[model samples]
Target: MISHHLLLCATPAKALCCPDPAAGQASWDSLKRLVREWGLEDPARPEGIVLRTKADCLRICAEGPVLLIWPEGIVYGGVSAERVERILREHVIGGTPIDAWIVKRLPFRPAAA
Candidate 1:
């Protein structure tokens, strides 16, 4: 069994940039490239350095391009191609979560009468 250290929870919509799979395969391809560039499969590293997951819904649709880092439980949102580099260079490689792009969960506001 491959023990993955990083897990990317990607949805089909993320690939299409749409809510469904009809968005074509471009999104999936982009993500795959990122995985490779991140050196997740390096043999010298831990047994399972990285893994990808196809999530039906992570409940953060508004925040497309979201990825979750396990063990730490840090959820990153609104990720783009440009940001991937920083995420890898700083977060994944540096062992720290990037606070600049982090999606802050604000408290729910009640409707006023």
Candidate 2:
């Protein structure tokens, strides 16, 4: 089962979100490496696997390279390659969100299935 979906707005269609696209790509690479290295994709683990997506734009224009953690709906801004490790370890695994980096929160509200 999938535990969480990490949506990274790394490459926006327009340059409004991130002025430098390379920086965003770097962050995206970091996210992929950590996710795979940490064994988050292992189905044998009990906590479920974490899935990541490289989104062109999340529609939040100011926070270039923003990371949105779904279900809990934590939106983190200014997510550089360096910050990706901390987020995965602290927020994703430890179950505690870093308040300082958080820019917004939009908890998921699923409609009746």
Off by over 4 Å in 1: 1-28, 46-48, 104-113
lDDT assessment of candidate 2: 0.90
Alpha-carbon deviation at 31 in model 2, angstroms: 0.4
Cα distance off (Å), candidate 2, residue 32: 0.4
Give the TM-score of each candidate.
Answer: 0.61, 0.93
lDDT of 1: 0.56
Candidate 2 ranges beyond 4 A from true positions: 110-113
| Whole-model lDDT values for every prediction | 0.56, 0.90
User: What is candidate 2's lDDT per residue for 1-113, written digit by digit as tens?
Assistant: 88888999997888777888998999999999999999998897688999999987887878778999977998899999999999999989999989999999897677879
lDDT of 1 by residue, 10-110 (tens): 45534432343422133344556776876776666664556656555556555556655554556666665566667766776677779977764433355
Q: Give the TM-score of candidate 1.
A: 0.61
